[model samples]
Target: MDTCCAKALVTGKVQGVGFRRAAQEQALKAGITGHAINLADGRVEVLMCGERTAVKRLAEWLRTGPGAARVTHVEFEVIEAHAPDDFHTG
Candidate 1:
């Protein structure tokens, strides 16, 4: 149960499409913590911290996003874990 963090940039039809909210919900369901925010460059930034498996699952989900999201690409980097109390949308 190694804990870890992931920073992901999700692109394509992500803004104004419930992507952040959906990401929050998914993170909660996966028992992960962090935030999802819309970037100015038409991308969504997601930071997730949790068990390695859960974080990986969340990253996989980011590739598809909510049904309305076009999700052209998802780029991610492994980071030091932050262990936030809850998931949020920004």
Candidate 2:
């Protein structure tokens, strides 16, 4: 199976609002592997690895996050891809 990876910088109302949890759930559902964390600059950074379609879906969700989240921007860039047996939140 082919795979792709992306490192995304998500900004705007993304912390202390279940953003990380929401991202974790979404990533798992999309069969992705990576981690999402809150940065000191009030932004969320996520590294996602998975199939192309799944990665795209995850990115789309990042743009319009959970009901409580107000994501103004989701900057995504392709990165090195790897094969992971299971998805996880780190």
Candidate 3:
């Protein structure tokens, strides 16, 4: 399958709201590989690597994360990186 990598900076009430974990679950369900990590600037950095469609789908989801997340904005960009074997959260 054709695969690629993408990065997103999620902002607004994402931290401490199970955003990373939720993202991990979503990524795993989609068969995507990457990670969701917290930034000191209060933004969640999500890297998705997999089929283009799946990556885009995950990016869209970041717009409105878990019920507890008040996702105000999600900045996305295409990137190049090695895909990991599984999804992760940090």
TM-score, one value per model: 0.87, 0.87, 0.86
Location of the lowest summed lDDT over 10 successive residues in candidate 2: 79-88
- Provide the lDDT at 2 for model 3: 79
lDDT of 1: 0.92
What tens digits encode model 2's per-residue C-alpha lDDT throughout 1-90? 778999999999999999999999999988999999999999999999998899889988899888999999989889976656797898
- Model 1: per-residue lDDT, tens digit, 1-90? 789988999989999999999999999999999999989999999999998999988898898988999999989999965556897899
Candidate order, lDDT descending: 3, 1, 2
Query: Each candidate: what lDDT?
Result: 0.92, 0.91, 0.93
The collision pairs in model 2 are none
Task: TM-score winner between 1 and 3, please give it.
Answer: 1
lDDT of 3 by residue, 6-85 (tens): 99999999999999999999999999998999999999999999988988898899999999999988898899765478
Candidate 3 wrongly placed segments (more than 4 Å): 81-90
